[model samples]
Target: MNTATTLPRGPGRNGAPRRGAAWLMLAGALLLSACTTPLDPRKDASLQQAAYTTDRPVVRPTRSVSSFSDSLMCMDHMLRAAQVPTTLITSKQVIDYSSRVPVAAKDMIITSLSQMSRLSNAFRYVDYEVDIVRQDTVQNLTTILLNNNLMQLQRPALYVSGAIAFVDQNVVTNRFDAGTSASRLDTGYSRNRSATVIGLEMHLGDFRTRTLIPGLDSANEVVIGSGSQGLDVAGRIGSYGVNFNVGRDYALGAGGAMRTLIDLATIELVGKWARVPYWQCLTLEQTHPDFQRQMRDWFDESGGVGQATLVQNSLIAQGYLQAGTDLLALDSPALRTALTQFQIDSLLVPTGVLDFSTYERAMRHFVTLAPDGSLQRVGWGPSGPTGSMAENKGDSTPVRTSGLVLTSTTPPPRRIDMQIENALPPGMEPTFEVGEQVFVSATVSRTSHMYCYFADPSGNVMRLTPNQVTPHSLVAANQALRLPDWLVPNPAFIMDASRPGTERVACFAAETDVLPRLPAPLQGAGLVNIPGYRTIEDIDKAFQQGVGTSGYVKSEVYWKTQPKKAQPAAAAPAAPQPAKR
Candidate 1:
């Protein structure tokens, strides 16, 4: 009877054993959930990650003004003293190696020399091209032969020749890797360094004597640094992982390198030939004692106010003046007004007088000459924020006037026309009829990158400069470029009978190509209409309505078109020939 009663009691509700089993099941479910969820114990902890980095450095050649300024000044003085007409004939091949340079580089050297000649009156230069010279020669010869008159050609006393040589070498290499075993991140860093040594040589030869000018052979070397960088990153957490790498290299084009080399070479050669007194301006204590004394006296007397005119000119040269304003007049109401405005803009004390503080502030806007004679521009240091003249107003440094007035004379030396010719049928007056081909010949007064376009009678504008034919925008000085190489009004486009009127062929010239900024809707049925221009005159008016300081020249030609001719009456039945009777 006792054993039967014990068995029945096993089925009792809310027993201790049943409650313990339910609690055990709940605990097991919680353990399983914890095991399946992602866990990060370092979620809010600051831990280092793996990193990899690489760098390539490109070093550019720098100009040594002190080393060459003396020679340049000497040459300038000598050329002025001699008063001889000179012609500089630079070798087309400036580099001795086989590297190719841009044609613009050669032209740039010539342009630089020509500009120097104009500014210093060092020598009378012949700025004409070979063709122009030949044409002039022919005309002179004809006049001389027909009139029995004598003509003379100015010859050069010395012919300058220069060549550049270069050597590139890797100088240094570095690599680094760092990481902790407990972290899932790692990083690596690497750097490669290289140097380029450029050698410049120049010699002066006498064409008449067929000998080298004594003391005119010169050579110099410039060193430039170049390199590259790379970065690598890799990490993993259990099955999850990520890897990434990137790299870049640095280098300069042959054209740019050659340009820098040529400029330095020309400057040095000119200096040597002229025998510029290298110590005249540099050895201020020796040659200009009295001048230095006067500068000191002036600084004390006027506190930099005496040189207001110089400061104003410097401001104008630096483009601080608003458009169409006259140069500031010294000691006048106009000058005071301008100075006050400039001070306000530059965050100065707003004093209208050209005090020492004002002079010092203005000088910071320009290039300065270093003690070693190198030209240094503000904010161009290797390890500092570079500043530009455009940022002069934002500079907050207090003006320092210690030696400002003494350097008034040494104010940093700072330093487009276009023509369009219409090619029409012989004896035509730049006018073309329907179905007749219209060709345009364009030339610029200076070397520039240009953009050419045409607005047709249908009010559609088409790009002509960067077209399929001549795909480059570099237009050399005085060089002729023909538009639409093969006669316009052909298959792609023809004179529209319904919209017969004047079509304009316009060309814009600038030191650099600015075609990308041209208004859009570049290609459509009525682009001119979108601009609200109905006629060529309206387009021209709109085109001229831009800031005049853009350094761009616009020239256009107008051509008219009429209805196509009727098939010519079928030759009028062979004119009945009267048959060559």
Candidate 2:
């Protein structure tokens, strides 16, 4: 359950704070004196919020004035940028809520990570566990729900998240440097417990999601982290949905002989770190002085990380090459030489001094190769075409899917009080039937209306039964279909599209979706509403029947394709027409 070792810093937002941490020292003393039992998965448990328990049930706000707030705030901003929806816990009620529960402890870490996932609408959930090492130092766990490690892995990534550890010699067992700069460095000798956890990191998965078999998620990741000196972090995951890779390396404080134990841990994590270039792919010490710089270079050369890098490079370079000066240095006489050397193509006359243009070129390639772009299909082209052939040159992406929603060219129908009735002149009774489309501009309320009609062109009218198409979620958005042009005046009202005949499409219901729902707003020419009206006892009474369509058109209407774009140039987008309101 524990993999204690040292890992080098991967990325930094900023350092932790000072005064704000006083509470930790205060809490540390309290922790030493408190009667609370050491947290044991078997003892302390988390309260269930839904189906799972959390890590820290009770999170008492830091009592001492502190600076960690800034770190927390920065983290919040970073997560948001990642497109993760984070809900800051706003409770002022502080209570020690954690108890000894297995799920609760695990939920602490797993849950936090999972929240990251939910922010992005990614994976569904997280499951975690906790094991206590030093009892008197800290109490219960802090549950962190993790995002779907699986999903991120499928997409491939280079992630860095964790806690830090501080070791100050001047501090004795209880007198720690938790709230001061002194904590960052140690002021004493060996044999004494000189290090404490500063912050911890998270797990990263490579193409695990894309290549992993079926059932696995986080289990595929290899966790790596160390505290002030080094903290424990160990988890072996090899479930479904992933391909496995093996790697290891370690060097702490300028090659000062780090333990194999530390070496093993880093190897595990960076093996998973991945997405870094060939230079970073080498062992740590091999590129020690400038590992991170090397990594940046690799990331730049790799065309960003994920399922579509090379394809993206070719697209950005489309037609820009005179010789080797292609938009992306992806082609020509020079880059190929670098590729052969199994090294990143540096930017230089011949030395690879990659400049701003290189990065811009890489960015362009990465952007164009976005998952939904034309390059997605280039994989289907003849095996490995030459650099001269631009991939998207033969682009065949769909202009729009079968249900692609388009903006309206006209206004929509109107809402009418179908419950309202119109009074007729004496001896002039009217009946509506098939053949005449009720060219309406408004829809009526969602309910049953007394559909009354007269026999012949002048007789007593009778109310007819309604076909099933009541209260529906239609009309909420882009829902609108038209009535068949067959409805005529009849004592017995009939619905054409609702029947079975040459025109009896079928007994169906259409609420006006774009084949499927369009992901846009629906509007039209100045906006119109076609509302149906039902007669009541009097014309005035029917007028007060309310608005909205009382019935739904029953049939299947479809949209035809646009004229294919003429070749030789990108077609200009069509101007939007007002929707038929």
Q: Please report the candidate that would top TM-score against the real structure.
A: 1
Model 2, residue 146: C-alpha shift (Å) = 26
Q: State the weakest 10-residue window (summed lDDT) of model 2.
A: 86-95
lDDT of 1 by residue, 158-214 (tens): 565656644444433444444334378766656666666656666767757767778
The per-model lDDT (C-alpha) reads 0.49, 0.26
Our tally of clashes for model 1 stands at 31
Model 2, 1-581: lDDT tens digits are 99999766443422244444776888898888775765655433443343354454653331111112112222322333332321211101111122211122222333333322321222233211133442232222222212423222112232222221222222323222321123222232112132221112223332333232221112111122222332222333444232232333231221111111122222233323221221232322222333234434534544432212332333223311122333344454444443322112211122232333333223222212312432222222222223322345554433221111111122233232221011223344222233322221112221112221211111112212221332122332111122211123332223221111122111112323221221111111111111231222221223223222332332111111223334698789999999998
Instruction: Give the TM-scores of the predictions, in the order they appear.
Output: 0.36, 0.17
lDDT score at residue 185, model 2, on the 0-100 scale: 29
